[model samples]
Target: MRALHPLDFLFLSLEKRQQPMHVGGLFLFQIPKDAAKTFIQDLVADIRLSKSIPVPPFNNKLNGLFWDNDPEFDLEHHFRHIALPHPGRIRELLTYISQEHSSLLDRAKPLWTCHLIEGIEGNRFAMYFKIHHSMIDGVAGMRLLEKSFSQDPQHQGITAPWCVANKRTKRLTDPEAPISKFKKFTNTLQSQLKATPTVLAELGCALKDKKNHHPDYVSSFQAPSSILNQRVSASRRFAAQSFELARLRSIAQHFNVTINDVVLAICSGALREYLLSQNALPKKPMIAMVPTSVRQDDSDVSNRITMILANLGTHLADPLARLSTIRRSVINAKQRFQRMSSDQILSYSACVYSPAGFNIVSGLMPKRQAFNLVISNLPGPKESLYWNGARLDAIYPASIVLDGQALNITMTSYAGKLEVGLTACRNAVPKMQNLLGHLEDEIVCFEQLMTTCNQDSINTMQHTQPS
Candidate 1:
């Protein structure tokens, strides 16, 4: 048995009915053209009959402070084959996911589930797989997903996540002569101690800048108590939409920003419009806790991410201006992380977020908030992927919405498209589906900006040239 990291244990300790601390993906796939009617049934049966024993995370269950394989693990309970009701439209599919996402995972079993769903409107099916945050984070989760699927369209049979070998076992140079537990603990402590001074110095600068209210310096305490920071119920609402990667890239090029910066701006514009429509737009801008991965390799699956607070600049009416502010804030935060080692980055993040964490777990300061919501952008397979010969269509990520943080927006890039998923507290965020339309409108606005800028540049160049 291996001991749980402090971060992992925190996730397990903080979970409740109001906040089901799990992250999931909704993968839509197209059935092969020549497939028989029993395709779905046969696929499920094949997965059930696989001789491979579940490994690591899928087979790991909580045992006090350590993770141990369940001796009597029930594969049937963790894997379910379900069918959508008649007419099985996308709405019904999303509704089912939202309902299931709201429920808490059973602690007695491994904290994960894979649901094979069929009977959709088109000749497509979806796989909804969710695992507790304690087991894996978004980046680690994506790595597992890539290994389970295939790049070749003709790849045969299905390989569930657990079937993938425990890659961490090979990370150690000599598994047979593993270092002693005392040595490992001491080494970790020494590195953390070395990081303490640097991390604390940065924290000092942050506090000083917060007092000045510097626009570029994002202070967590600056977030306003908007509807998004309200207490949440057990119910959840999920929506997803896809956008072409090329268009977003074009906009990022014209604006001199990263793709993630563009994503933040798009979300900022959509949220602005959504709040305006509901007459709940906060006077001050909203702050987003953007999660960044610090994992150097695929060996570690547990959480190795740090949260960076970003000023969304929702107060600005122009999309370009908003994008500029978003870019500056994000770049500034990233520059800080770049200066620090991974361990230092994690320590600094812990220092910066400890109060908020305490508030979340204890509910001592329910009104105070560090950030309004979470906006995470996770990378996905660039090439088309497949499973059991079925063409993988899109991958939408459904993340967690905490009690105080009522919404989460997560996006993944796959096959030249950006698949976005929005998870929200159903009661706190009304008409959340409308945000999808708002996001498209924002994209069009940026496209027009790109066209006008390009035209002006062309006219200037032509005039400057001698005839």
Candidate 2:
């Protein structure tokens, strides 16, 4: 058995019944024409027989000092096939997933499950696959998802994530190694000692930038508490919607902003409207904890992220202004991030996410004033993917929410559409479904801003023309 990473262990040790720490994905597929009624059954059989399981993350379970796993795992315990209740619309599918997402994964077994859900409207079926956050991050999870799919639609021998076979016979990392506090302390001390120069250099740069009075530093804890900062419940409500990727690309191209900046602006506008309806708008721009992927191409299934605080510009009424501010803030943050090494990134990220663990250890919850919420963006396959023979329609990412952080917005751009999944505490974020509508409204408003600004510029050009 291998030892779980300290960061991953933090997720396990701090998990409460009320706060399930996991990330999930919902994939909707169009059932291929001429498929047999027993197609799903056949697919299930294939998965159960596939025999290869990924290690370090997928097959691990708590075993006192470290993680342990069964050499021959029971596949049936991890996979379930469910039929939607009668009149199985998309709404029913989401309701089923929301409930399941709230419940903790069974620790007695593997920390993952796949539900092959049928009975949805149209010639379609959906998969709600969930793995504990300790097992994977969103980026690695996305890559893992490709295991079940095939580039060739007609490829008959595809293996699902659970049964995906490991081809190589080489030994993986030694998970049975002893872990000690003294060793941990020494390792940390060494890393810190090495990072000291980097820290001093960063501080000097900050001081130098302060002398220059840079306008883009977004410090944390500057946000006002709203209804979102209240205590969360054990219940979860998930909402999924898709927007045309071209629309976002068009806006980003027109504004010369990154797609992430556009996403932040959209969220800023949506939260602004959502909170306003409850008469809970904060006078100051809200602070958002945005997790940036720091993983290299060859990184393993661990979470390598840098958490950056972003000014969502909620106080601003104008969409353009919010977009501009988000763009500038993100650009500045990225520049600063690029200056740091991997060790520094981990140090900064640990400092950023440490409070939740501390609060749990203290038998307290996070305060609403700590931060507003989480917003993440993960990129996905550009071309269409097929599972067995069914064409993949959409892939919506379902993410985690903490005690004081009531809501999460995770968007994945799959194929030509951007699928957004909003996960929130059912009690804390009432009518969280309305945020989807607000997001669409903001997109329209931004389009109008582009139109109006273009017209105004044209008018100025005409007025300044020489006779």
Candidate 3:
């Protein structure tokens, strides 16, 4: 009976025949000798017993639609067991699972799906999980995984946090009962009534908010006559690579910036070089739609989704100057976010960001325009985690790329490594492999700069020291 929040519903509605909006992860684990089968069975059992709770921003009923209400919430409906055919390499397994995860899940069932993959080339196993964009953002999804995993390698006897115990509370089955019906109806009415005034107030505040200005960071919508921006097929192409988290951290420390800032800077430098190579670099600075989570409080569950358009100072040749520009832009954006409530921020994002792109790509409008790309950095488990004594090897995240914005870059840090997953329209970015190289080159560029700065400092110290 509960309704979806306007923003949540918009994300769900953006999914059309061609494009499916979902965020997913591919997890690699080393299977222990005796516990592989046991781990799989226990994982299935845990998913079956787990119950999904309603979170804010969506009505309880609407939030429950994908989990509690859907008959396909059962384990067999969402979780599947698969074995790779002969000559199973990591590339083959990842490619197969990526395509599977890209397909739309049944709307009539839970809005999530998981594939437990076994019998790969070695002792390694893989798990691929896809959840509807409406259900959880990347940060919340990471939290769920952290909660499910054990910190200790020898940990046993404790079920995943998502698992239901034998004495768990059971949901009522009789929907037609007077008390049940009344409570549902009353809750729906109350939610709607509460949202009405809040929506109006947000609109009023948005009018007064000058930070909502849309900077023209890219060229005017010229209907890019490219294969990438056109209608997409249901099929998808996913690529991933990993780098040492310590290396990135070292770069960040050397530059006096956060790890995320370094990441964005690297993307900026790479994209700049890539575009220059194509001779298609835009004159103005390109803007990135950076999605920032607002789940600051523990009690809150997936409450916030806001975006800031970041100006990637690709025009700046100096790495330090580019980092300084990015730092300033991010600081200004964070200050703006601080001034707004969580509801107001999400509402503003939907109104300013989501609609134009959705409408244009959905073919509702002839010339819909928005930011050029999406760059998301989602935090993952800091410590190494295990599944039934098998050490997790790698965790990679794949995100959605819409028609206009033909590229999506999502990064997650897990097990002291920064895993970067790049999903792009295959035709749009034909030489996507170059990006991996570009990322490496940018990192090296930053390191070189750091080394120069350090040697200069050493020379200055030696000159000042008594001879």
Top candidate (lDDT): 1
- Higher TM-score: candidate 2 or 3? 2
**lDDT tens string, model 1, 1-467?**
55677688889888988989999999999999999999899899888988987877788899987787789998998999999999999999999999999999999999999999999878999999999999888988888888888988888876676777754733322236555567766887898999999998888877877787766888767788888988899999999999999999998777666899889999999999999998998888889999999888765457888998888988889777677677777777887788898899999988888889889988888888999999999999999999989989999999999878999999999999999999999999999999999999999999987767566553442233111
Q: How close is candidate 2 to the true structure, as a TM-score?
A: 0.89
For each candidate, C-alpha RMSD in Å?
A: 4.3, 4.7, 6.8
> How do the residues 245-277 of candidate 3 rate in per-residue lDDT, one tens digit apiece?
888899877656688878988998988888778
Off by over 4 Å in 2: 53-56, 165-192, 203-215, 352-368, 454-467
Off by over 4 Å in 3: 33-68, 157-231, 299-303, 354-358, 361-368, 453-467
In candidate 3, the residue pairs with backbone N, CA or C atoms under 3 Å apart (3 or more residues apart, or in different chains) clash, namely none
lDDT of 2 by residue, 1-467 (tens): 54566677777776888999988999998888899988777776777667666454567666764666656567687788888988899999999999999989888877888899988889788999998887778877777666558777887777676544332112344434666756866776798678767666665665665567565656545567778877789999999999998998887777766788889999999999999998999898888878777777644465666677788889999787777666666767677778888777676556544764476445464453445888998888888899878889999889888777889999998988989999999999999999999999989887776677865543442233111
| Model 2 global lDDT (CA atoms, 0 to 1) | 0.78
Per-residue lDDT, model 2, residue 440, is 97
Pairs in steric clash, model 1: none
Q: List the residue pairs that clash in candidate 2.
A: 1-175, 2-175
* Residue 279, candidate 3: alpha-carbon lDDT: 77
